[model samples]
Target: MKIGKQDATYQLERFSKTQAEFDEHYEKDLQPIAEKLEEERQKTMSLAKEQAKKLIIPALVALAMIIFFDGFRIYVIAALAAYGAYLFKDVYEQRKKMRVKIKEQLLTALIQFLNPNFTYKPKSYVHRNQFIKSNIFKDDPNRYSGDDLIKGFVGNDDVDANGIKGTKTELSFSEIKAEKVEKYKDKNGKTQERVTTIFQGMIFVVDFNKDFEGLTTVVPKQKGLKISLPRFLSGEKGRRLEEVELEDMEFMDKFTVRTTDQIKARYILTPGFMRRLYEFATKKREVQPQNTQKPETLKEAVKVGLNVGGDQRRASQDARNVAYFSFRDGKMYFLLSTGKEHFESGLLTPINKSLVQEYYEDINKSLELVDELNLNLRIWSKE
Candidate 1:
């Protein structure tokens, strides 16, 4: 599964291959790696089950003690937790080993298999500064960590930018978790700390085909009565952003825009551009294993929007409209709140063809954003 840098570079042109072609390539090139991974998967599951069986007797005894003798209940509960962790240490280590192997061997190959132009980094992430610069989320998060970084470019053969046909658009996305802590005094005068999640999802950044000045941010519209307010009036810092009203009713129904330059915002969000955004937001592109009774949890997040100050508490399944995007620095920053880690082999599931297909589909769906947003067509040159 070790792909040399030169080979990967040579295969950069394969980014345009269709899913059927990928399936053909997987069968021909990746079968051996998949078989080796299956062996590791089976061994890991057997070890986990053996460890689980050993815990049953002690767990039942602890449960009986808690039910019969309530005096030592708290101590027994704490002891049980400690004992469980100690007993499952081997299982945890085994699973971790299996996880890393899959990431290194199978996942890495699958990424390059899709597009060798793309580089997959399981340990690196998009920087928090880039997140801040996005200007989509107002609250700054103190804690941030991410992995499974995929970076590369895809060319639209039919589109032109500058003097060149087939414009190459750079795009990258990774799973990120950003959180902030707040300290507030309770009614009893004891200070308590609460950790609020600022944004927990995929941060997708892509090269904008057009050049525009200032920053334009589009976020999901607030429910109930509608009122547009300036960013400074609403306590936003830096650029003075004023809300831009659009003519499209459906676009207005789905989003609200704030921009430092009103003219550029209007120019960027044309009726066609707005329709593409709305269509992409509402599209049902969920990637799950086919025909599985118990599919892995790859469903869209209920609360995908930025939960600033712990304001958005309810889980909304129709968070398709819960997207955030902004234009700045010759790039379009897009955020999809898919609050789950994708493309990892399940511990209990076999690492077979279906698992590999699932991985392919997940990355493919994300890459589809390029086509969905029509990012390859240049609208205007930089001033």
Candidate 2:
């Protein structure tokens, strides 16, 4: 289901209908598993409570004895703690394994219900090299780690009855974390090392149906003190790349476009295409109220670096507002800092109809970007 300008509403309606069917299937199929999980959870909780109750009195008694006899205080506390750990170790391990199993099962079931063709890996993730090739984030490949990768096609591979051709788009998203160690001095003037998060969010990659050899990066505009910084100091190496300017004032105001070739950038970022990017960025900002509370206007949003992808050297840059865009090898990668965990099944909450609807909506939101950004509408490019 390609969501075009004229049929956005209709595509959503169709998705809603499909989601309703999935919801019914979920209730019918997953209810038994949910019930079993609930039972196991209650049993685990009861066992933990009983174990804690049995240990608390002894631990308190040991503490009181230590206060009276200072000689054996350390030994007494250590003994009590060791004993408590020994008592609960098996139960804790058992519960942990059970939870992992349940989580994997639920995720698999939910993903299958959404689309039988799709595959969900509870432990796999998008590779760091892929992130670098995507040019979404400017962190060292050694610093990147990710997990929980979901990949598959959405919509139909065949043409639908409405005369609309279904897109065979390959979509994948994963939770990514990139960190670097910084050496700094504390208040006491002693040098210390601290780990800083360079990028922590979901990185999404979609196959763009068209193949292009050049790289086009659309980052947020930089101004003020940042503009005066040297390329080396700024930690960005693509200064030699031509900065292409689009005709749309709003898009130009929102994004700083760069490409290996100026003509290719212009062809890729058409007025209609830039408008779609602007709209997507605007929608993402609006969804995150915590970050966009002060920016009331779209221009202000862009000025504050509301779009993804910004100057990597700006330490004070807000990761939530930044998204990185990269085009390479017939694929479009979008690095979004949503600042929250996604596709997680709750421990206590069952996978209900509403929950399934939310998952469906999120998947569609990602897929729609392929069409909305005009990724398939290639110009001056060979497929």
Candidate 3:
């Protein structure tokens, strides 16, 4: 199998010539282009940082002034004002950030929806061995306004260690619970063995009765919202929690919704952000004033509201009724419009049902596309 030394030498020389040519070409051509690109990127970043510094100069000036002025009360007031201004700026920025996140989450969902193989319509999809049917929430033209439909499914139940059998009171909210330690298929071809519950009957229709109306109630002294969710019956009681009152604070609304709609494999949007910027930009907008028509109290901080003058502005004391279909985790979050905002208090709300409907319908339409394209993409990736 051994070859002669002369033949080997000839092969080695040939290889050396090719290697030399490759090194020369790559260094002269590809390397320069890559280096130039890197340099341009650095320059762009440097310019951006410089611009940011210039924009922030006023904040620095305010800080320096506060430091220079030594009178105790004056200094404190000045410092507080400066900090407050910064806090306001930060809040506006954060709201915009949240909006962007929401947009991303929605885009991802829409992509998922568009795909036929992964996510078809809610109803008539094959789930494992079972062929189940589900209705797309938006597809139903007769959908109710608010969460009145969801509210009917909450009540006291006889949940024991053996498992939830039935409800104590014969109410619509008391749903017939279902368990899954084995395997079950939902209508959309999703296979899961996790224990879950679904509301039964024509009157009651829902699952995961948490934050009933998607309306969050803030805990009395806590910064977070207090949400109430039903505890499903699981086998074998633990040390203490198996025998607590249903109204126990420990079993309250602690589960935060996947509101942060950031998606790497989808589009997203944030709410109540751009409007806030517009508010701050235009100082002291004339809105509905209280009884006195003047600022007599402290709580009426809103300076923007109903301007009953312009027709195109669409000024009305009452906000329009709308609906919500928030998709998070693996479930759809639904909400109904409660009422319109009062026209007097500059309370423009989600009153335009048409606009809200369009948003919801568009999401439903886009979802299949999103699912088809974003099948294997990482859910939480921002990029």
lDDT of 3 by residue, 270-381 (tens): 1221122122222232222223255443222211212121121231332121222233223222222212211111112222222222223323322221222221122222
lDDT for 256 in candidate 1 is: 84
Candidate 2 per-residue lDDT, tens place, 1-383, comes to: 44523435323312212445656776788767756766776675566556766876787789789889989988997898688777767656656665476547765676666556677776788887777676544445456777678788654445567865555667888778776777899999999988866666778888866656667877666643122211121134653556677789888887777677677676667676678788877675323223334677533432343112222212233444466676665677887765544554332334345444544555555555664665443232242
**Scored by Cα lDDT, where does model 3 land?**
0.26
Query: Native-vs-model 1 lDDT?
Result: 0.69
Using lDDT as the measure, the top candidate is 1
Model 2 CA deviation exceeding 4 Å by range = 1-6, 9-26, 62-81, 155-167, 182-193, 221-239, 284-322, 343-365, 374-383
Compared with the true structure, all predictions reach lDDT values of 0.69, 0.61, 0.26
**Which 10 successive residues of model 3 have the least lDDT summed?**
168-177
Question: lDDT tens digits, residues 1-383, model 1?
Answer: 12112214223232344678778978887778889878876776676567666767776788899999999899988987787677667766766777788778888888887777799889988988888778776576788888888998875445334444456678888878888888999999999999977776678888887876678888887685222333641234666878888899998878888888888888889988898888878787553222213333312111111111122211234333246788886889988765455555446566788777766766775566776676765344232
lDDT of 1 at 265: 88
TM-score per candidate: 0.77, 0.70, 0.18
Question: Residue 371 deviation, candidate 1, in Å?
Answer: 1.8
Off by over 4 Å in 1: 1-17, 156-166, 187-190, 224-238, 287-321, 378-383
Tell me how far the alpha carbon of residue 68 in candidate 1 is from the true structure, in angstroms, after superposition: 4.6
